[model samples]
Target: MQVLAAGGDLAQLTASGLFHGASYGALGAGFALILGVTTRFHFAYSLTYTFTAYAAYSLTAEAGLPFWPAALLGVLAGTVLGVLLELLVYRRVAARSGGDGMMPVFVASLGVGVAGIALLQLVWGSQSQPYYGPSIEPLRAFGASFVNLDVYQAATSVVLVLGLAAALRYTGLGRAVRATRGNPGLAAAQGIDVRTVYLVCFAAGSFIAGVCALWYGLQYTVDPAMGTRPGIYAIVVAFLAGTSASPLRVLLVGLGVGLAEAWSGLWLSLQWTQTTVFVLLVGYLVIRAAGPLLPRRLVGKGA
Candidate 1:
């Protein structure tokens, strides 16, 4: 109430929320791809992409490379790392364990995440550094201020997400991936190379993660731990959207979460932001869980 009365600028908040929501949606969609197909919880994905952004920013800022080339380098680095991990580590584990090697893969992913963070600390000394791009100046319009870069990022995210979703729905690669996800053995028996699908999925997810990292880097400083919280939130968003949910739903859920997070900051202390988000998540889960039971209970009572 106090913030609103003091000219809180709802429009600005809305724009920020949309931008953040798009970011989260991108993260969620990527993670969903990896999770849905691989069935391996990739904890390292967050840090991996963050490292890519940091490395790319450093290349551009310190190495004197142009932004596009630097960004491409960052994305390629992340994608290669993801594909290598899948091919060298997870694939070997799966081969040894007969494709149910989720435990080894999961543990290895955690170890890799820790190693990535430590390596980043050693190289960057845990400092937060800004990207080399021009400072984002807000464009004021309709009695609201908005950052043009942020809006551009949001648009890019949405388009990429929609495009990926469409590809998954209509393309042959998408069918192969879906087939592999449904049953690797059957897919393999049907002449679809499961390994190839896995490689594609991992690479695609990693590329999306890299894009997300770059966009986030544009908004804030690049730090070793920058992706941690958002990564966790992305997992939650993925679950909320469900594996079979459409891309638009996932995007909408992400946007809702972003809006909630941004709006809460106006009334609550910054420290309480995560707490509020989790509380809302829990409340939503409880409602969703109980919603189905209510109909059953009512039928029983009527009977």
Candidate 2:
């Protein structure tokens, strides 16, 4: 009877939103890890995502491998490809066009991304690749229904996020990554291989992207440009969480955003839901930017 149930019941929408949000958490956290640590904008991450999805689809549909194995192999291939991008393209540019990277990093990333997109389009064309990996039955509970893939995706995200948090909090490698993120120059001076740290971030980030690609292709269709929206959303979440935000915090923020997006469907058309989410994000950013300039209220009715 509530307004939020105009299109569907609250329970159904909430269930869907929660699962969708879990993917967002994973995507956002991965982007943040690389961007925060490596200082690379990584526009080419979309290429990695697309390639991984297609690779998995090929293995499953053409090679006759099971979905899980295909996904794992595809993720591995994508991870290697990402590391190659870092080592072959980004690192070389950083060396040649050095000076606190006035503009070269941006130019390099943009160029590589464009070139990669063109190549993919040339090879795969603009046709959407449908995934026929597995047959799934919708599961229902509490008057809500969802598929098994949703639960698997959410569980994987939660487990990985928690493991990442623990590693960042308590491990020696974590301390090194923290130090490098804080000050690469100081880290290099202290005998920390800053380049190695960057490499690690890229590998981890790309591996996450591959996992996302797997779940995404399974749930939806795959296309060369499929990564565009997810990539943009991940960047927004990373910035929304800010430089100081913990990985767990990023995941929580993503979940909250997912819920907001779902609730927004109560009033807007499905076509406009994504746009509304960005509008809301912009409003939040404006308020955050203005908050620091505003004066605080006096406590206890006294100055």
Among the numbered candidates, top TM-score falls to: 2
lDDT of 1 by residue, 1-303 (tens): 244432545666676777888988887888888888888778788876887898798889889998989998998998888888888877776678775777888888888889888898898878899886656777876556777788778888898789888988899999898888888889999999888898898898888888888878887889999879878877888777765556677788888888888777677766775676688668767766677577765434322
Candidate 1 positional error at 58, Å: 2.6
TM-scores for every candidate against the unseen true structure: 0.88, 0.90
Q: Least lDDT summed over 10 consecutive residues: which range in candidate 2? A: 294-303
Off by over 4 Å in 2: 1-8, 296-303
Residue 31 lDDT, candidate 2, scale 0-100: 84
Model-by-model lDDT, in order? Answer: 0.80, 0.80
In model 2, state the lDDT of residue 245.
61
Model 2 per-residue lDDT tens digits across residues 1-303: 225555346788788778877778878888888888888878788888888888888888888998789889999988988899889988888789866652677688778877887887787778988897667778998788899888888988877778777887899778888899898899999999999988888898898888888888888888888888878777777777764467898888778777777777776767777875688678767766666565544111111
